[model samples]
Target chain A: MHEAAARNGITARFGLDFPSFALDVDLVLPARGVTAIFGPSGSGKTTVLRCVAGLERATTGFLAYDGQVWQDEARRVFVPTHRRPIGVVFQEASLFQHLSVMGNLKYGMTRAGLSPEQAGLDAIVALLGIEHLLARGTKTLSGGERQRIAIARALLRRPRLLLMDEPLAALDLKRKSEILPYLERLHDELDIPILYVSHAPEEVARLADHLVLMDGGKVIAQGPLSETMGRLDLASRFADDVSVVLPVTIGAHDDDDLTRLDFASGAIVVGRRPEPVGRKLRCRIRARDVSLSLGNHADMSIVNILPATVTALGETPVPGHILVETALSGGERLVARITKRSSTQLGIRPGVPVYAQVKAVALFGE
Target chain B: MLTGDDVQAILLTLRLAATTVALLLLIGTPIAWWLARTKSRLKGPVGALVALPLVLPPTVIGFYMLVAMGPWGPIGKLSSALGLGTLPFTFTGIVIASVVYSMPFVVQPIQNAFEAMGNRPLEVAATLGANPVSAFFTVALPLARPGFVTATILGFAHTVGEFGVVLMVGGNIPGKTRLISVQIYDHVEAMEYANAHWLAGGMLVFSFLVLLALYSRRKDRVDA
Candidate 1:
């Protein structure tokens, strides 16, 4: 019945109030690249992922990706999970407990009408760094290793898109770090699109080319990571910004223990970007930690900036400053707020400009 | 010292247990898998049919098998056409009846194991590239090892203890299917208490040991 969605975008008619679980997500983002869906607990991130995978039915909606339409009430198109060209990596890394690490990956590839020879077993093994784990039993694997194998196994199906529901959520810090590179590499190396669900803003910032923010089953904000989280009114709308993630290309490493993170227009001076040369990193900025700046301060080296295009300008109930946004030419985006008095003195308006200097540590931690 | 009849019954019972267990395994595995996975409307009826012998009298199963395998039934017709003659009152007939009567013992554990495994592993297999059938083979079967063992042993032990079914289907044909259970009953009825005691005691020990072995091994596997 998902044939309708196979034709175009998924349109959920359920609106923002889901009667059953009270979750309402409405977004028809391009089904290519990584569209990360983030939310707090009970925010329905997994449910949305499940919906796209066709695991669970949406009360009312139409989902379409690429050229394939998955669900549509108007057309009555619905595709069963097996018939869908999608792969899912569950939060539990549900490896076939009966099979070896190698066998688990091979299981789905074998069914996808691709023989071991055709699927290139070694490529996946190498990509997930599971060569040594091939013969090992699934029961013996560490949480991170299991998830890597789970991802590898899902990939072998040659699916058009991948669905990962916090695949790294079960891992410890060390394992999460260890597996992050592979995930990053996977996004770059594969041609297929991915829809990742996570509560970790760090993952969204670093991995998502597009972000769909969810709260209480609704799409609160969506678009590129910086643009979406860069909304000034976002913090006041919610108690505090859950996470503010930004993607930046490395510019250079400064001698003063700060790395030059080249954004869209200006460079940010974060302590370090943990990647090799030319690697992209998702650095986080917490709203609670950020403050407004009118211009570059000579005495301070606290290095992030907002060239301050006023994406939004208004009085906040907190009786502080007006929130502002500035889009950089580099395609990178930032957010800042100056006091209402500062806005008046600096003559900031919807299109007026200013600077948003960031503190050394903002909402950037895991 | 026991007579030649006692020894003959012992050998016959062993042969029956071994044959029944092997046949049950071959026949029960596929049936259990089907019962475990299929959601057909007939599943309830078919499952009950498989379990019928466990609760019903053994003589009923033996009588049905005898009728189905007699010179008048299709199987009997086919056997005679092939020059195999009548099936009733033969070792083969006894074996078939035992397989039917002990079916639930073999199938239930296997079905439970399959049910417990759930669809997760199979789905995982499908996503990995295995088609449905291969996934069942590669992922489902291996995990049900302990259940298979339990079914086989229980079926074999139950078959060894059968008296009524063997009597109805195969009769007390010496050196053929005059099983130990019938022999023990015969001795007791004839007031041959000592001989009955010997055979009954042996059977009790054998069954206890089989159960002990099955459970101990199962516990170890599970614990491991």
Candidate 2:
């Protein structure tokens, strides 16, 4: 499996210079699944996507995806954007205003010489919930609706890769929630690799499988999303939102306004979730929400008390705080931020047994 | 009460205007698109050359065209060498002169339209598997309909009303080089006030209608 994955991965190296900006990136992105380029504005995230899409040619670059060479500045070999098999979802949708939704969708299909059945137009329309909007003019649609049609249009081309550059940045909160489930459905069902660019932590946490964290036109860290998010050393870069991601399966729905989720080590109870039993979900455990105790306190209001062993401890950015990395019995890792005074009082050190009282678990739909 | 000469001149003017606009659409589109999208150092110089006619006096343009189309001029020598003979006083000579004189009228509006359409739509089209040529036809041209309409109207009207350039390059031959503007000059020179008034009144109404149509269409586009 490892050999097969390495053989099929995408390798990209780009270097560009402008009067006010410079971008330099070298990435070996997964050829399948969603890999997010997470960064702040002006950090060159979108520029990287544009380079991959061939919309903006890098001054010096090389890109080879799954044995196909898309660009090589050294060889003077560059495929024009139109000939590249890729679909792009811009931030504003960028639908052709003169065309109806159906016309816009057909634009790609005709250009690719693919019939409706071959392009899976019916399935895509149903998947994106845009069947009712076939004949509607694009200018008349709302922001969320326009984005859905844009996504459907891109998919109709049956591109080998899909690039989404901050696709949700233009929408309001309600619109964002309305569109996110469709995006998740696309991610689950589609076979094409997706390079999603965004600066929103919540959006990245909810959807990304692999993470590429960037700052000031440089990549700070990159790895699997769960492992990267759990690093205590990088906690300061994310401000106070550092946390660990737990892959959980829905265990049971109780009558006491709670649902049980089974993780590696133990079961966690959270507020009621509508997902059915046995459904897989991701839960985020914020470090600040956990409290360390030397022994299980029966008088505490927190219901979660799982046995854990101190694995490592590091100083936090705050003057009087410390970050603790602990391993549960099942070898699952959890991080907690505690006051330095509390750590001294509890005599917390590596190999010492403790109980972690988890105050919250943020459940995400599968 | 139109005479045969008046009718001939009117038909000739219509044909000339139609031909001039058709040629402008063909020749000016690429120039306009290039001006809109190029950042090269030559853009300023080329743009100034295209706009030179807008500020120059038509009589001066007429004088230069007259000299260039003369029997010994370079264009005349080339055409003569090709067995096409000299261009002066011919219908084709007036057509060539009109094309140069009315160039900016046709190019500027189309250039503005292309500039107003930012790079997003074309980029989207490219990612959807359209080459640059196909993207221009499929996306750029459809969005630039208003600009084309303006160019056609302006190019046609400016060619119709031109007097100095036509008189200089085309030596007022009836049924051949005798355009409506030249015919009006004939009526006035002969002191035929009644004929002059008839042709002049017709031109007045036609120019007003063309401008009225342009402005009303522009308003509709804005509201849409």
> Highest lDDT: which candidate?
2
- Residue A285 CA error for candidate 1 (Å)? 2.3
Per candidate, native contacts kept equal: 0.55, 0.90
Best by TM-score: 2
DockQ of every model listed?
0.37, 0.86
The ten-residue window of minimal lDDT in model 2 chain B covers B66-75
Model 1 agreement with the true structure over B44-132: per-residue lDDT tens digits: 99999999997898877777788889899887888899998988989988888889889999999999999998877776654454556
lDDT of 2 at A353: 96
Worst 10 residues of 1 chain A by lDDT: A8-17
Docking class of 1: acceptable
What is the interface RMSD, in angstroms, for predicted model 1?
2.5
Cα deviation of B15 in candidate 1 (Å)?
4.3
Candidate 2 docking band: high
Model 1, first chain, TM-score of 0.80
Candidate 1 lDDT, tens digit per residue, A217-278? 78888887666655665655433453356655678877777677765567677675555446
TM-score of chain A of each: 0.80, 0.94
Candidate 2: stretches off by over 4 Å: A1-6, A312-323, A338-353
Leading candidate by DockQ: 2
